[model samples]
Target: MSETPHEYPGQLIEQVRTAAAARTPLRITGGNTKAFCDEPTRGEALSTTGWAGIVSHEPSELVVTVRAGTPLAELETVLAGQGQCLPFEPPHFASGGTVGGMVAAGLAGPARASVGTVRDYVLGARFINGRGELLTFGGQVMKNVAGYDVSRALAGSRGQLGVITEVSLKVLPFAPAEATLVFELGQHDALEQLHRWGGQPLPINASCWVKDDTQASAPNLLFLRLRGAVAAVEAAGERMLREAGGTRMDNAQAGPDWALCRDQRLPFFNAPSADLCLWRLSVPQTAPVLNLPWAQLIEWHGAQRWLWAPASAAREIRAAASAVNGHATLFRAGADGAPDLARFDAPSPAIATITQRLRAEFDPSQIFGQPA
Candidate 1:
């Protein structure tokens, strides 16, 4: 909240040092908005909320360096003021979401498929390793070929490797034009159309297909967003409407709808029953309709799928995802709280070896809590 930056690198280092000497695991926390994201780890809390503020912003360079604990909303507001934004459109999840949590979670919104992932925009980062030593990687530039790009790896480490202290991110200017189109298409038809448009030079940015139980006449629909230069957007919008047979939604209505989809506030995201958990499937966009028996909301042009089903169905769900060369994550547990299932799929043998090596190098004593 303070205009000036609030940093405590010394205090953070000292705490880590003391914990390392005792071989104590530390759970790095920021805002705690995404605590439910991964398996909860037990350890002494290392709160990063106190280490907050924007370190620098170079609108000309399209980069911003900020302390890890700076509020996500505040960062977005600053970028909006400059007519720029984090192209990935990271999700806040809740009010207290912080920059550190955003990078750590590495979950992107609908536009992710078009722009990139959180790791793509992460230019650089600084963190405190298990040895209690502060280390920095990458820089505030688009290209840095000096050393290994370990900075981008911190994007989705989930605090397992170290406690992220600060980060430099690449931002992009807002699109000069934007438009949303709605089509009354079923899941299969919608995906077919998206794949077709994807092959062309269309300015398609984001797409969401869901069954609107509230609308009896047209329950199945696909909401597509296009953003780019004025001419491109206009041309794409007209072509899609004429050839695709859909109506253009007013910006005023579409804007909030997209936001809701980004933050999982849409009705489709709501759990119909307390026993059902939220599952996220990351598959190839061309993957066909899954035969799973559950309500689904497809996004990212069919790459990301959200479903609600009991945790007991984990085996079937995970198998279904794997068949399409994808992975399934138990994004959120049921109302009863954390389930016995793993939050993420187990890494393959090769990836597991690399992950273990990285953890050993950065966190030799395993002082950082491991998310399952």
Candidate 2:
């Protein structure tokens, strides 16, 4: 199929219907930047770009409805202009990752630990189910019905079950002002501090720690962010600073710092000459957490760890994570590895059964991954 939808209809319903009729698989691509996602897609690829835009925006209601193909960056720009934000701070997977991809990938940024995840903010969705039929659920208004929230299910499905064409998201007004409280402490103490804050209602956006492994002398710099009014932020920082016995650092790169943490592009991302494999580690927020000697970047308040486990020793990484009830995925592997990468961790039997059923329902003909 040519890039120009010359013969094919750019409509979401028509596209899926055509794929179903042809028995061709469909691969979904919004912004194609995050190619290092879950399993490499098979069959034909579908682009949601042509079908993108914000259909509804009620600033007062704090809700916005948009087509699935919209770029998150574009949405963020619009929301920022309105003094609002996505709250979850979905990562920019790549230059091409779209709103659809954001939900499907089910990845959230630093603030995720505090506010909520992507699925939490999704109000509803419209999609072309596996049977090539367009289905809609949820309402334009926030906090509506609970009848089979397909919108939440659609998230992280990777277009395996349906083609999401429209979405309703709950948004929040941007905080009146923003500030990050930065302090460098020992890794042990930093981790302890994170645990302590987890128990309190103290306002914080993201808590992250970075270590310089080789020297073993690197300060485990911890960062805390607050957004709202200037006075509140200042007061919170001052209180927290005194409580932790740490002072505030410069705020020059506060925003960028958060962004880098979300995209996994910090110094930790460039592990050992930028040659080590990058793994998105998901460990439970409990005792005896992962203790690595090398440099590690903590985001989502230790819920998510961007690790650099080189030599493609996935077995060691997986084994360690499994021992502690943790899960790991090789986000970016070394060049020596295979191109057909596996981004999913082991799934439970029940989940497997459910996933298979969902696949059958949204993609009876299995046309979703079929790139057009």
Candidate 3:
């Protein structure tokens, strides 16, 4: 069951048309929870909060169609009532996070490595193009292949292409059981163990490795989560405890910890120095420990690494990631802020050309803010 649909595509289209004709850029916003994630954009504010509500939800069909401005928490709550969930675990940085922001940011939570990314679940989308034309792509089912890739590409576009009005997402039922295990290991050893366990038939859903500065006695910690059938979770937990050497944590205790990690509420995310910027390095899971000297928090089975360093270290940090066939993003600037620092890695020449062409086609007047 869903609430009454709040359809405001007409108003959004008119707004885009006015901006396009006037050659004025429009900054798309929904809850503005992730406003700090990207470089600042200057434009007339185009808010989507008025265009909200769930259009449809079929639990048995494993799909939900929702208006872009609907709150992320509201959608999650509805799914929970149906014993379903967004398996990628999109992060709500703050209370007012919206579905549109989630799709635009394309950020997944702890289960990303095991499940997939935000783009993987985007089944369909309806957006207003720069010309103020309402365009729809993909569909509510996986079998609908027409324009499917286009819909998925919009997941991380950050409003460069268009204003997303509504989207249909694939959902999954909650796992029957889940367990969390913690181990005492250094960064290298934890990465090795994660790689080793990754090869086996285990139910490892998510993992995090961080130095618990709050607990001086036991600093290095690796927290692993398992999800699946009751028997499989139990078996995997027991085997991990015996082979890996760790303690099983109570769900009541571990659940909030996992949420904290997902939403970046852990102490490791806090900047110890006002000048230290937060960098997110996306590298291969098999990549060895980086040689950089900075505090780090490893996630997504070692594929996603977070570090705190000054903007001056940007070159070195990016070079290290590139050496391992990866790229790094300046996720957050320092408290004083580094406006000159590039927030994202530069795309290859070919990709850059393609991106330019796409932007020209979708937003010929350049009425939308720059791409993320």
Candidate 4:
């Protein structure tokens, strides 16, 4: 029998497989806050809390290679020291989300539009396939693969693509300063504003719309934040304000607010009700007057939004998402939510097929978390 160690279980991969080989259903966890995810299965629950550390950091080369278990906060801290960061700017779950969990889940925040998505920044990875054997693919260099690179396939495959052991990513130097532009607009106009600004070649990094279910005055608050060199960020901010009319918020608080907005990991940390639903909504900005059916807390220039509804409201949320040519998912169904409502989005056909094939390639034995 494999012994689990204190503080951390070093041979986490082995421990996970041991459970799987026994035909025991395994639930993978990190931070364990989003544990309510609708996916099903049971037997032994495994934690990667012990597998934490940074293997290497090449700030000058704009690369940071680390153990899968490292906390995103820690990694970001180190990157900030060097004025560098994960360009995609993924969200750190309120319960202290880990880097490994970040990659396995392929989550990104507001910076996605301008900087690129999580899959874009991943350069390489080390993981244990379903067979319990360690595997490595891609490398330190970006644009290394000429064809299918297994390194990136791990993104969004969930934990079904074996357990990721190490991660290598391409980072970027941080700008000297940044500023945010906040404005209130109706849902109908917000869609227009998003389309207008998203089209310009501005240096905007993150844009979002905050919507209230009641559709109060300026029901949707549109926020645009631009960053770069001190002069550059300010210049872009000024130009954007001139081009787009909006009230500006003190950017000093923008960092924390951005974190809270993207992951709902903050401000909503202790929401008043356990019945709150957090969703990631994707829709077309060009679409005219989107008839958003449910109550939503939107973010990321309306590209990504959160739907707050009753646990039984998932079917409607899914339908609304479909109408917008987008999708919604339940990372947290609410305080008292349903298990089946956990999965909120139906990926595009291409993404769906790719996700499935990746599961097969990485976990041929079909032993990870579930059948991909």
lDDT of 2 by residue, 1-372 (tens): 012242322366676778788887778777776667556768666777777777778888988888777778888878888888899888884565688888887878888878889888888888877666778888766558753367788877777778788788899987777778877776667777878877876677778887766565666788878776788778888888888877665667677777887776666666574556778778876535565544567777777777676745677777777888888888876765545445667698999999878777767887765422
Candidate 3 regions exceeding 4 Å error are 1-7, 214-216
- For candidate 3, lDDT tens digit of each residue in 1-372? 335333467878889999999998899999999988888877889999888889899999999999988999999999999999999999887899999989998999999999999999999999999999999999999999899988998998988899998999999999999999999999999999999999999999999999855566856989999999999999999999999889999999999999999898988888888999999999999999999998789999999999999999999999999999999999989987787888999999999998899889889999888533
lDDT of 2: 0.74
Give the whole-model CA lDDT for all candidates, comma-separated.
Answer: 0.90, 0.74, 0.92, 0.70
Summed backbone clashes in each candidate are 0, 21, 0, 7
Overlapping backbone residue pairs in candidate 4 total: 7
lDDT of 4 at 337: 52
TM-score to true structure, per model:
0.97, 0.90, 0.97, 0.86
Report residue 79 deviation for candidate 3 (angstroms). Answer: 0.3
Residue 67 CA displacement from its true place in model 3, Å? 0.1
Question: Which portions of model 1 miss their true places by more than 4 Å?
Answer: 1-7, 214-218
Cα lDDT for residue 358, candidate 2: 76
lDDT ranking from best to worst? Answer: 3, 1, 2, 4
Q: How close is candidate 1 to the true structure, as a TM-score?
A: 0.97
lDDT of 4 at 59: 77
Decoy 4 TM-score against native: 0.86
